[model samples]
Target: MDSDMSMHASYAFKHTCWGILLLFLAGGVADCSVVVTVSGPHVAKVGSNVTLNVFITGATRPTIVWAMGDIPVVTWTLGSSSPPDILDPGGVLSIERDGSLSFHNVLLNYSATYTIRVVELGVGSNTSTFTLRVFERPSGDPMCSVTGVNGNQDLQYRCQWAGGTPEAQLSFPVLNATSSGSGDFNLTRKPSQDLNGKEVTCVASHPFLQRNCSVTARGPADFQPLVSSMVDADKKLVITIACASTSLPVATVTWSKGNQILTSGGRYQISSNTTLLFILDFHLNSTELGTYTCNAVNILGNQTNDVSVLGPTVSDLGLFPNQEGTMVTLTWETPRTSVITGFEVQMMGPSLLPSPGGRQRRKRATNEFGTIQEKPSSARSTNISGLDPKATYRFRVIPTAGATRGQPSKELRAGPGGGLSGPAIAGIAAGIPCGILLILIIIALIILCVVWRRKRRQTRYPVSRAVEKVVATQPNLNTPHTLLTGGLKTSAGPPDYSVHLASERSSTLPSVVSPPPVRMATTV
Candidate 1:
């Protein structure tokens, strides 16, 4: 039995050796070979077309099959082509019996990692993996622009764009990333004045042959300097304009009449202190009248200010007391225009009130013509003869010359309707209250002095008065002590039996003969 078992083992071992050799030989040859794989993109967008390959060839063609996300695409075999058939239709995929796979109008849901396998009738199947990914194109309006950072410096923004089945390369102009595309960007740009308000654009590129996406940015318009002025009668007008603070941008300042531009040759005259953004002063003469517009401008913008210097502002208008009458003394020193010829001093009141509106041209006057006009010193004192002490009137000296004639000077006095006229208010109304206040002050001073003196005496000599009253009750100096004792007698009781007193003589009163006994009177 043991021998038989050994013999059986020997045969089994020999058979196994033969089987291994046969397997090795069979691997080298086959009836047919299968090769399955995906052509086209590994990651594809939805609604797309792709070719899936499943080739079976060695001997006779075998059946080939394909599937996407669990849905079968095709199942066929191309052998002698017994009968050809078209299985799946539009939006789906298909494959001929020959093992050629085609995907039609794909959807996002169709996207997946697909497995393609080919089988040679009796042989096993071979498969390959394919991954699909879907993405959309980008869209929007993008642009670039520039704004002022300082006087000479500007900032820029670049807008960029792109469209594709996936992220693609986006091109943008020289600009800050802040405006670059619709995605991640950073502000990075330095611009010059010439680049300010300039236009820029961006172009996007994608792999497929599609129209490129684009965007552009145009920026900050030109800025005009804001101009302003303060009119000064005794000095040149100080003109100030607002402008960019950095880079010291240059500016040209000018003067004009009304809205007409002024030139050095024209009647208009102007002077400036600064050629750039700054605070400056401009002088205007009496001749440069009407509407004085100070203009400031640069390459960026321009600004104008219209200052109405109507007339010669009168200073020091008064009446000098004179023996003949009141002398009208007036000074023409002020915001004088070259247009003023001189002045008219007219008197119209005193039952002869001429101009109630303070504008009576047909009144009496001492015509005064000015000399060395541009100089304030030339507008010194001018005397005019005028009478009427009890009458009240509004007085004014009008200026006329150059453009000064077109624009009248400000009113010197609006009359009593506006201000105090003549001596009526100055003498009766104002002076009376002042006089009353002075009298009351004097009376109060006298009363205060009396009260102060009385208080001082009480503080310095409080007991002296009481001692004098006691001394008055006694008579002679023969016994001054006795006399003092006599005053000690109480009105309600007899005198005390024992009493000691110290005698103190005042430096003012004599110690010799005394006066008769006299009681000091007291009252409540």
Candidate 2:
């Protein structure tokens, strides 16, 4: 036991002797009076680089040592015979010959008290320490929200900034309020009368980011609608009205007549949110010409408009028949027309034609035929078909304009088969002259044929008959050649004798020697 205790005491004595010798050596080297100081920024952002420089004066050759919170991290010496002069344990530190230490890609763990020591070859070491602060930049700008409180008399606004190392600051100008709450800030203010329609603003600020947001205050207003009325072509009364309002909150529009509420369906058409159209179709009467009202309501107040109705007017009226006489088309014209619903046609006809049946049946048929017909206003004309061909009928037209009917037109009559139509009469007129000319031509041809046949017989058989006749007249006058040579008859005298002989032969022959043939007849 004594021997072990003496061994431990000798080991402690040797360590103390070595420590004192090192201290004396350090004092002697520091007696050269070399001074070292460090200068640089104390704050740095994460992901940024920083340099802490150890500045030494009055030293020709110096060594640098870097430590973090009393833990040695690296050391550097100049012109050392050793293989490695720089001792960086974690490879996060580097040093320059000027005793400047640099940290790359600094992190939160790097935020600490850092000490830099500088030693001259024959002088003692000098040390300096500085606190390093590392912070992260804000990821985004501040967000702001505004809401109306206390019935819009006051407004509350908040600004928020998140995802940053340090808290953000918020401010409200309109509200004159500011408060911070864990990266969020809020403010509320009761506005004065002068602040009406003013803008509310909130601004936030941080070391790395700054942002602002704003909103405006507006109030509601009142408006009235404009209304008008007219009669449509379909004889329906149309009411048109529109209203508009400029308000923060939208206004509602409605249509009404007297105490009756009108909506968008059937006869009432809501053309737009602000416009309406009312059509009077079924209960069409003069009463439809009345005043209409439009109401536009908002938070501010309500307004109304009244428009009186403009009734329809009547114009030119006429009637005519269709091309086919079986159907009669009644036509009439409307001038300055507006919203004419339709036309109505009324007809009265003579009693029905006598039938093979009894008188009671005919009377019933006549009653049916006299019934009136009506057509829509769009159909400018009314066609009445299936009428008795020989029967006569009277037609009258009435124009309806917006629940009002115009004066009836004058009556017109028509008969389909009572007499020849215009076309038939015109054809007869044209054919009469041609028929007379044709009959005269036929008589003339017949006369020409008879005369020609007589001339043909005279030329073919009369010479022999003349000789035979002379022989019969004078027993020895046998031949026409003897008569010709004897100069008994000249050409004129012989033609006269031939005619006289022809007249004796047939009583139809004419005298005056027939004046020699004007045109000779050819035998075929």
TM-score of each: 0.30, 0.36
Give stretches of model 1 more than 4 Å off: 1-32, 41-48, 59-61, 69-90, 108-111, 131-136, 139-164, 171-186, 194-203, 209-524
Model 1 residue 112 CA deviation in Å: 3.8
TM-score of 1: 0.30
Question: What's the lDDT for candidate 1?
Answer: 0.46
Cα lDDT, all candidates:
0.46, 0.61
lDDT by residue (390-497, candidate 1, tens digit) is 434444555443223323233233222344535556677778888999999999999999999998876332344656876688567675464444554355666444
Kindly report which residue stretches of model 2 are placed more than 4 angstroms away from their true locations once superposed. 1-32, 79-91, 120-122, 149-154, 177-182, 191-196, 217-524
The most accurate candidate by lDDT is 2
- What C-alpha lDDT, on a 0 to 100 scale, does residue 385 get in candidate 2? 71
Residues forming the 10-long window of minimal summed lDDT in candidate 1: 368-377
